[model samples]
Target: MKWFEGSVADAISSAQQKRCLFIVFAADEQPASVSTQESWDSDAVGSVASSSVALKVTPGSDSYTQFTQIYPVTIVPTSYMISPLSGGPLEVVQGTASTDELLAKLQSAQEKLTSAGSAMAANTAGAAPAQASAAATAPAPQTASGAAASTTPAAQQPSNEDKIAKARELIAMKRQQRQEEEKQKDLDSELSRRESGKKLQEYKAQQKSREASDRRKEMQREKDEADRAREEIRRKIAEDKAARRQKQSGSAAASASSEPVSATAAAAAAPSVARPPSLPSDMARIQFRFPDGSSLTEDFSSTTQLSVARQFVADRVSDRFPNGFSLCTTYPRQELTFEVDDQTLQELQLSPRSAVLVLPKTTGKQRRGGSGAGAATALSPDSGVWKIIMIPLLLLQAIWQWLTGSAASSSSPSTPAPSGSQAASQPMPQASSSGDAAEARQRRGRGPETGSSFGVSKEGRVNRFKPNDGGDEDDDMGTWNGNSTQQQ
Candidate 1:
């Protein structure tokens, strides 16, 4: 069977599923000249992984971290056999062993487990019969409540036999009963001792188990600290490497830019026949294609500086692309690294027939503080953010419109029209709706009666008097206009 290759946890799960021990450890370093993978691939050791799961571990890898902590592995190629049931180490097999011996060891462990289980089961079965038989043969015990008790009359029993003979008999019986009581006490004491011893053993077992768990946890904590240290080291190394690469790129760019007419021009203009045969010199021509499909060709010395090539290509399309550009190869295109900028055209190793496409320079600015806001461009005012910003203004505008509409409706006047010639003397036929007349009366309560702005109340009270309509004008009020006002 093929062994499943994964982390320590996966190995444990597989072991539990298969009901087998999980073996976890790293293999010894093989000699550089060694031809075979002897530990896992060889036929001799194949069966070892077939039976129990094998987990491979690296010193710094997270895989099998718990295994390394729980089992001390001072030597390489050490193996730990862990029980699937308790998830604890069952045995540690050190060094290498022959295939037969390894198989024998595994077989022996299996047999021992099987035999122990059988022996326990047999002992339990045997004990059950014995207990049942003893219970069946033993008489029922008389408890204090079930026993028949009798009282001596007048608290005295003196004359049943001759006094001396009865007394002697009673004394002998008392001595025998006392001896039996002593024997029963000795038996009870022995039982108590055995029980106490058993309890002590159980407590010791629990204490040991607790101590083992504590040790495991401590080991795991140490391993975690070590892993974090290793991670920090790796991060530092990576940072150092990146810094070196950046430094190299900077130095090269500085030197290449200082060259007046870089070596590329000489290599390109020099005739190939004049070059030495051993140098494998060739005149390579490159065409830089733009996004618009219009391309420009530049004949450069295969040893040309990237900056020279960049300047040449930029000159051809300088009108349209004044901002500068980057050159990349096509067919699984990749932008050329600046590290290659200072290198000769020969170092770049472009095939004589290959072409480079000119790409626009990336328009990204360095942020000062490295904040997200600085790194990211603020969205355009016409973007979705602007739409969200306009929501509140739209709501406020709508609210203002509603408020003005409500004020306009409430402040509007609803005065009644004058009925036929109230100005001329006839009190025209009773008037329109009483509702309008009632509303006019309510309006009069707020302001004084005036001539230009006037109304008729429900009581036929006119706000203004027509001077010639048979009515008298009181200071800011009206007179009765229909009948007796003129006569008075």
Candidate 2:
């Protein structure tokens, strides 16, 4: 489509002179307009439109204004085909069209233009005779009346130039409206984007704060648990210490109760001994544990003689151990006998807070008794001595009873009487047998009735003795007895 570079009126005059169809293309910068232009420029459509006079008109141009007066373009990319003879549109293609469609439209417009030209020629030849005949029979016209004839004919209908101006105004108004709409749409899009971004930032901040709060709560919970664990440990430690202290106090009280009153009174009445001038004035506190699980505490000057300490203990336990007891220390175990008695407590390092043990002295007689025949004689009924004596005696008694089963019955008065001498001799044997039976009964009675001699009897006379280095010893100094010395 080679568009003629001329004004709309000139293009129409040229089409009339050439006796061809006048083509007008109206378009804008819109994409549909460009597509339509391309279609028309193609070889197929261009070849078909080549014989016609083609004019291209865009918006806001003089040619567009001139063309839109007769054909107001409501949509862009419109094509108009005007007849050269009639100067009226023959075909109109609105919006974009394909190459084939454009070709068909051009062909149709050309046929219409050719038909219009033929009609005009036929009408011209026929109209010449009609005019001659009318001239031959018609009368001359009368002149118009004075002023009415002079007045201008009634105002003619609006011309093409007026229509073109109105179309231009409309196009301008629509273009302004489209510009305003695009501006408003852009503003709306920007505002929405900003609002969304703000919401996202706020959500992120809230999530971060929530996470931090959760972390803090977890830390606090862990700390609380740790504190509880530590408190439980501390409570357990305190309870154990209290239990130990109570046990020690109970034991001390039991030991003190078992001590002799006479010895305790004597100890209380004794005067405090003077200490050596070289020693410090601080007193030493000593704890004494007796063999019976009893305990006592005493205070003494550091320089006081060890003999005085020994005397103090001696007086308290004098009745229980007439031979006296010995004292010893446990840490660096050493006996505190008469040999160390003359030494000052400080010299023996028995100062500050020290613990001593009271062990009963072992006498020569007690040791001898523990190791010798006296020990065997003093044994309980469960001892080997009692087992040896009782088992055989029991067996002998059973045998004797079996053998004498019918002797007494057979010796009845039924037999004839013996001589007087024989009878006197039989009486001596009977007396000896009766005496032996009495001795055996006495021995059986002396033995413990129950299995264990040390066990308590109905009389509550069971004696409990401690084991010594020499083995077992009697609590009494005189003789063995199955009774406590205290009970005796």
Candidate 3:
């Protein structure tokens, strides 16, 4: 008879595929006794091994551990019939068995298989009414049905000696079984006690951990309270000192007022620059003196745009200039006009600690009233002032550009040419004038509103307005920006 022998996994796979049993023997056992060899050499035992997957690995090997885990082996030579896929034994035989015992066990397994098939067929066919009634009423059977019952021996009357021997053997088996049960019970109690002890230890550890965490939290809370108490005491001390100083100043004021006129004048003449408290330390200190003689002194952060300063002045004054006013710096004394609305105070380079005059815009340029002590309006997409003024200007400018572009396109040559907007953008061919004395004057009078090519004057004359009168007149000699010289 041939047998397969290898690792646990290999034996298992072959057993499952061949539908056979896996039998293993302990290699560490004292060499097989004569009785064990005789049992193994029997025809029945040899046939069993030949018909199944068989393995005999060393006892203490890694494969042995794996094999023991899959199919429990409390004793060896241990034989287990198993399905390889489940990794568990279906039937187990502990210790060496005689040839007849092994053959009987195999026959019993065959009987069980036949019984399971019969039961399955019976379930599929379902029970008849008569059979169901009979089964419910019938008492238990004395022996197994079919072949099992046929093999069973019938009861017999026995001699006294024979009966005594049988009774003694039965008593011995029952006593052994009772001893094993007591030992199992004691082991179970020990395991339960150990489990309870482990739980207690875990519980005590958790309690200690919680206590440590609580102690840390208490310490942190105490420290925070102490710091707050110290801060409160310091604040109270500062307040008390300030109160005493204020009381002393009140008492000394009247006496000092009578004693210092010349001294006061000297102090006032000193170069002590005043500034707003909120100004950053690095910014220039500036004093704005209005035409009304009222002045504002503030520390100015150089980072703030010049427009912010103009808005600051506008916010404080009585005359509400609608178009916004200009800031004229002193010493160099020039009106801050170029890019006035966009320039930064730092970029304009206004002198530190110097004075500037806040002048109201002239009557004709006043667009709206924006003067008050209220907070300055922040710039946004929907700005109140720009919506009123810029929107109309942008619309008009777009219309003019479109009209010019259309006219240029119509007058372009018949051949395919670039779009009028591109053509208009290209520089026109330069032509020298005949040297007219009025040409300079002609250039000045070219108002942005006039229809002309290359910004030349469309009309030599424009309407002029008198300061006193609200009406306009077509004045030939009037300058365009009022800065151009009139030759007449």
Candidate 4:
């Protein structure tokens, strides 16, 4: 016969109060070689096994005589265990299976009595009664297998209270671990949020700088546009002034062209005005009245006619500007007449056509003054009586030419000259006398005899004058004649 057997001879007691046994029979019981591995973890629960061996039980074997050999008892605690097939922890026997030697003896005796008949062979059949008497007196060895069998029934089952208590303790520990993990996660999330906020602030600052740059560009563009507009207005103003000057020049030229054509058909144009006449010192001091009923009486001793008048108008008008002044006319309209009491003159309003009667402010034989009537009579062939007579004569000749149709025939450059007709018009004796008189005047170094003599030598050139040709005696005689004629 055979029996699986193990003993405490090679067992080690762990700090956890558990036993680690080097198995002697585990491989025989399962028909496979037991693992020899001693799996010692940090927890120190190690397993070991020996090679499979057969357990012998004959009439005189150690297993049959020793009552404690086959049925030795051990203690176990309430704990869960790992199941091989289920691959998880399972419930364990809870209460300690403490074995009392007396109780084990009594228990083993009963089992032996029950199994004595089966154990006896024909040759040992006579020993059955002696085995039965010994079994009744001595107890059996109580091992883990026997103890589990006796207590697992409903009447003798171990309580589950200890198992429940251990399960609750493990659950509490797992919950605390979960809480710690959650706290670490929260810390990580907070760190991420702070970094995001920093980046956002930097982005906003960059955006503001971009906006400011755009505004600067916009302002520069506006300034350029404004400068362009000002330049355009200035150009237009210059163009308008130039156009006015050209128009005035054209009108003056047309008037000169429309004047009478000479009998020789030479172009007869009006002479330009003489340069401002040099008057005596007494005539230089003149005064004028403004249009605002105000009089400006000042010494024009060193002033020109236009300059004196302009100064007076500027001074007078500036005073009235708070009320306002019109600039449409070159000169204002209110006229000024001569000879009034201070009160009346002060109260008078002058018109634009007002004439300053240039009379001698002082009178004596030695006083310096011009003969006004004679001076007026000295007007050039372009003005006064000469102009009046020439215009009528020109009109009559033009009408005569048109009626006779001689203008086309006789006016041509290639036409034969009328010998007597031209000779009668220009007498040789009078022409020769005029030439001799001009030669005498030249030798005396006289000034120009006519206003037409003063002129520029060429276009864009300075004005020049040819000296006069009359003697002083002749000049004085002419002056006497002019004064006597004015008296008549």
Candidate 5:
């Protein structure tokens, strides 16, 4: 068998360079005869080819058997490998390949290739530089460097194990660098985003300050305008009040200068003013004087003027007269005067001893009678004439007794007169002359006598009686004469 040794990359090159068959074998304590051609195809030579290995053992038996399998070899595994060296003396082959083994055959081929690679390297390392260059340029399955680098000695070349370890280490270092670059890019992007947010906050704060300043200015402007308007209104109100006060003061001053006195004062001065002169051509002048020194003269008829004068006097006297005072007038001439009680008093306010009531004769019997008659009548009693004479006669007799020397006895006391009416008629001349006279006086004194005295007159006035003219004395003398003649 031709010798060759290398990894899968070298193996394909050697298979072409040496044109040798790569035989495989199993490894065991007792190798068995196994066939490799039946187990592995000739095309199985690449990476991962060393994963197949064969072991020889009988099914259900504790005994070993000949390995029979074929497999491609790339990298060796740590598991058991079986041998196919069985038959006759049970030969223990170490690297020979056989049937009935899979991974064992590929592993035996790898061992042989490895041994050959060691010998080739030894031969090249001991050579002169010229020979080393020729040998290195020669077709070798185990070398990775190009022909120009092959002049280097075998001792200077990297071991297959060492090359693989360094390749793995380089790949891991590249991956670690890529991960660190990615992490740096992520951290930079995060920092940039935070800076952008801080700038946005500053911008918003400045905008708010601008808006607040504008609003405050607007509010202040409105307040100033309102204050101006209020001041204008106050000025107008003050002007109006001053104008009204001036107008009222002017009017009050004008009123004081125009009028001299009050209406009551003017009326009181009327009585002192001179009367207008009367026209002589006018008929029947009437004139009067008022207490206030004012005089009035009316050119009207006397009767009409008298009527007006009477009404004026009644009005003047109404305030002074009391209820009991009466008026009596004994009118004997022209012009009228008022009388109170018995006499004609000039004023009702003062009492006078006597005065005459004079009324115009043209006022006729009507004034002498009518409502004026009461003013002329005297207030007296209602007793008849007979009692009038007898009552005074009895009072005289009583006085005569006291005037005489004898003291009057109580039994012979004089009796009082009867009032206005006599008793019912009876026989006359029953007593003697003196006794009759005494009895007659007693009857008259018993009660009130009736005459005009203290009685109301026919004119509805208070009339007092007066002494008779002559009729009563004649009647009494006739009665006395007839009695004396009858006694003779």
Candidate 6:
């Protein structure tokens, strides 16, 4: 069947204008509904529905809801045949029906509409003859009444038109309102979606930050564990070294105690003392102390000969001791000579760690003090006894010079001139001669002095001071005068 394409209200208006039965079919997507739709589409059902205005509505459509307001659809695949004139339901098919059944229903509803129209037309015809007879019998006054009656329908026609116009306006207003509500719903949904997306981004950022922090913490923890492991290893190694040293010391002491006193003494006096066999045979760390107070440390296998250690020291101190040097230990004060150089360092008790002094070898000529001239040149300036004796004499001489200078300055004009005999007897202050100045310079340079009798002389002898028996003025230079203004 061909269904009306307009809205439900329009379809109803069209049905009324055409004086036909209005048919509405409501259904959802179900097997029964599908069967009913197929039946309506058949040629038999379409032929019967041709005399009616047909409308199809689905469950959620606006037309379906509008139709239901007038004639409620209580079941799926429901059909309603409404009489346009009476605006009442003539037939209702509540469920699925075959094509023949739908066509029979359509025919029955159409016949009802036809009968109602015929009844209304017959009643109108009967009233028309009665109205004509009454008009013919009416007097002059009744004519005015009849004229007013004739204008009544014309006046009511505009009222009907106004009511229809109002109804259409209300429908348009409702449609506009529904459109606005849908727009608002769309906007609200869009805002909610954006908000959800923003929250998701924030959560992702927070997750990344937390993961980075966790990774950094893990790396730091691993580094800390590694450091602790290394520290533990170093501590263990130090403890082992200390324990080994203690054990070696204890063994050495026990072996020394077990030997006889005479043997111990002999060993102590020997140039190369035999080491205890209990000592470790590992590498030896030896420190060589030079005569100049500097030291060198070296490592060697304990089984190496002592001559190697001597050669090692010789190479380092070659500039200082060209002749050679000997190594000796300070504790027992034993010397290591060439005779015992072939012995291993372990046999000499120099294993693990030990200190050896470097002594420059002395020649036979040096031991005998050399020739006289050689001995004299070899002697250093007498720094101890000579400085002690000379410092006091130098202070006294300085005091005497200062006093004489002050006295001469003060008595230049007031003192009377001395007679020849008094002048001759008084010793006058004399400037130091060139020879004495030269000797003073030589003494400052730490060299032997030739002229000075008060300090160390050229022959390395300290000259003694004697009273001047002959009263020589030059010889009296060592004596201090008691009187300030006159010589005593």
Highest TM-score against the true fold, candidate: 6
Task: Sort by TM-score, best first.
Answer: 6, 2, 4, 3, 1, 5
Q: Locate the minimum summed-lDDT window of 10 residues in model 3.
A: 411-420
Predicted structure 3, TM vs. truth: 0.23
lDDT of 5 by residue, 299-415 (tens): 443223333445544455455333211222333323343332232222321122122231222344664676565642322233344445556555555455443212322223343
**Candidate 4 lDDT score at position 235:** 97
**Residue by residue across 1-488, what tens digits does model 1's lDDT show?**
25557767777788878877576656545541122125445565665557777676755566646666645555466556565644444444555644565556656655544564477578667866765675566566576422322222222334535555754565456446545756797899899999999999999999999999999999999999999999999999999999988997897697568755657786675567657664235655678888998887766777677778877866677887666677798976878867678976666766355689887764445233444563343343434564455555545544543543343344323333322223122222333464553454344431222332443322344333334333444523554443436322
Q: How would you encode candidate 2's per-residue C-alpha lDDT over 294-326 as one tens digit per residue?
A: 888888998889989888888788887766688
What's the lDDT for candidate 5?
A: 0.40
Give a tens-digit lDDT track for model 4, residues 1-488.
12235322212112013311111111112111212111111112211112112232223344334522422212111222221111122222222222232124323433443243245344255555655575556555479755654443433322466545654565455345545655776788788888899989999999999999999999999999999999999999999999987987897788578875674334223333422345454343334434545544443333233433444555655654444322222245432322231222112322222234222123433333456645655654434565544554555544543433232223212222223324223322222354554453333222223443331121122122322343243222222121123211
**Candidate 5 at residue 98, lDDT?**
35
Candidate 5 matches the true fold with a TM-score of 0.21
1-488: candidate 6 lDDT, tens digit per residue? 89999999899999989988898899899999999999999988888788789999998899888877756566788998887766667777878899888878888888888898999789767867777675567564577777886764455333666756765565455446545755786799799999999999999999999999999999999999999999999999999999988997897788678755685576666444345644355989899998778998887999999989888987778989877777899789999989999999889999888999998988877757766555655442343443444455455555654554344333112223333333333444346865664554443322233343333112222222333234444654443222223223
Error of 6 at 152 (Å): 6.5
* Candidate that scores best on lDDT: 6
Between prediction 4 and prediction 6, the one with superior TM-score is 6
- TM-score, per-candidate, Cα-based: 0.23, 0.29, 0.23, 0.26, 0.21, 0.32
Instruction: State each model's CA lDDT, in order.
Output: 0.59, 0.70, 0.57, 0.37, 0.40, 0.72
lDDT of 6 at 152: 48
Q: Please list the residue runs of candidate 2 whose C-alpha ends up more than 4 Å from where it truly belongs after superposition.
A: 132-488
Residue 4: error of model 4 in Å?
53
**Candidate 4 — worst ten consecutive residues by lDDT sum?**
34-43
Among all windows of 10 consecutive residues in model 1, the one with the lowest summed lDDT is 419-428
Candidate 6 C-alpha error for residue 65, in Å: 1.3
lDDT of 2 at 265: 76
